[model samples]
Target: MVAALDVGGLGMDAQVSITARPEPISLDPRRTAVVVIDMQNDFGSRGGMFDGAGLDVAPIAALVQPISRVLETARRAGLFVVYTRQEHNSDLSDAGNEDSPHRIKHRRMNIGATVEAPSGIRSQILVRNTWNTAIVAELEPRQGDVVVSKHRYSAFFETSFDTILRAKRINTLIFTGATTSICVESTVRDATLPLHCT
Candidate 1:
């Protein structure tokens, strides 16, 4: 009856113990959450944004059903659910802004942009915008779920996800969907709370 959860950048494992005369405690759905990563059209199924990065969407689409189920279940249980997607300025110049900090790294790394354009101005990654940065359509954002815009690979990095989680007192998180080796991995590496990744 014990489990680990991931909240923001902190990871904590909690075990529930049963006593002889235990007081049955009701679970608080308000303390739980689920984070879905990069469920957009470009990085998701069919016409994703990552196609230019030599990334494929067919595999990411497989999680559609599972992620949808998690969304529904978490909502019903009153758990705060969130999603993150990687997006950049259309001009690609803002990525290098000094104040934002990500502006520097994003400008240098250019995770979304694969190769320089033939003219040496843009990149092939800009063509689709659907593959590299777009969230899959099947698992689109809803009015209730928190949608976060991530400039870096990790959703927890330089994003408002943590702020909202704290505001809602969400402690536990379940992560599912898209780019297991990329965005998903990055999130797990940074998540500090107790979490169950399925």
Candidate 2:
């Protein structure tokens, strides 16, 4: 059997057992969320940003089915679902101004350049509302899933992601998606910090 999230809950106070390092933990399903980060075409699909830059995306593509299964299980357990997309304005204003690290990084990657995806759609890489930033078909957000558009690797940066989680009372987060070392890790770090506390 696939090692999906072991979520078992019933009443409002139901909790799921999780095997963690150092010690085991239990969490309420109602207060948990599955956060899917940057599973966009630009990173996982052929002829998208990663492919256009000559990077191998097969491993990223391979994750879709497993993630889909986990998502389905989460939904069945009534866990909240949230998706984060790395996107910027068409004019790149949100990416950052000249000499800024964000703009410099994007420029190094040639982000926003027009490219023809394998799907035959012409789209600018990582631009908001474009095909490149759309979640892969296999894991598209269903009704009631929150889609958070982020301009940086960390989803909480200048975005409503944290607010949405707080509003939904989501205290536990189960993350899945591409670039585990970069975007995924960044979001995790931000999520654990008490940045909002004054």
Candidate 3:
């Protein structure tokens, strides 16, 4: 499909014509991967991150079943399945100071406050090895699945995501997960860029 996107800016009118494939493309099982992003308990489950933050998790929760179905179908079709979980070190040492402002915001909103897990482990939201950092049970990775733990919104950032994709000879990526505007979209945008995927 061809789209004419209006690129209007600074008192000027401009349009960019972009062509996109109209029909569904066939995938080669060996060269394609299904990337499931940030469907961790923190983002989708009750008493999890979103809940603790006081955000309505209904919409995010709605994605689990459908994504589970996709994962099943992808597995049956012999496609590589990669699950990305957003997590930080227990001490958050990798989070750096630039995100302190956001951390402050989370604190102000009572989102990232420390809490005790059902297992009686105390940790902030999305900290590594915590309940909130684990993938939802229904969509957990199987024996052959690939699990990538990421600290940033983009799965490819400072991670072995690209290396894995290349090593697996994956030329195409199918992405599905929560927070369309944040983690999911961030990964998609990065994947669409030419990033030496070979």
Best by lDDT: 2
- Model 3's alpha-carbon lDDT is 0.76
The alpha-carbon deviation from the true structure for residue 26 of candidate 1, after best TM-score superposition, in angstroms, is 11
In model 2, the Cα lDDT at residue 93 comes to 82
- lDDT by residue (1-198, candidate 2, tens digit) is 114455453567766677776787677787888889999999999877888788899999999998999888888888899999999998888888888988887785678888776677788998989899999988999999999999999999999987888788788888899789999999999887986321
Estimate TM-scores for all models. Answer: 0.64, 0.92, 0.82
Q: Write the per-residue lDDT of candidate 1 for residues 1-198, one digit (tens) a residue.
A: 112221233224433222324573333455766788877755664433445445665677777877777676666545677888777656655354565766654434344455543234434342234344545666777788888877677887778877778788766666776678878888877776444221
Candidate 2 segments exceeding 4 Å error: 1-9, 196-198
Best by TM-score: 2
Please list all clashing residue pairs in model 3, or write none if there are none. none
Score candidate 2 by lDDT: 0.85
Q: To one decimal, what is the Cα RMSD in angstroms of model 2 from the true structure?
A: 2.2
**Ranking of all candidate structures by their lDDT, best first:** 2, 3, 1
> What's the CA error at residue 111 for candidate 3, in Å?
6.9
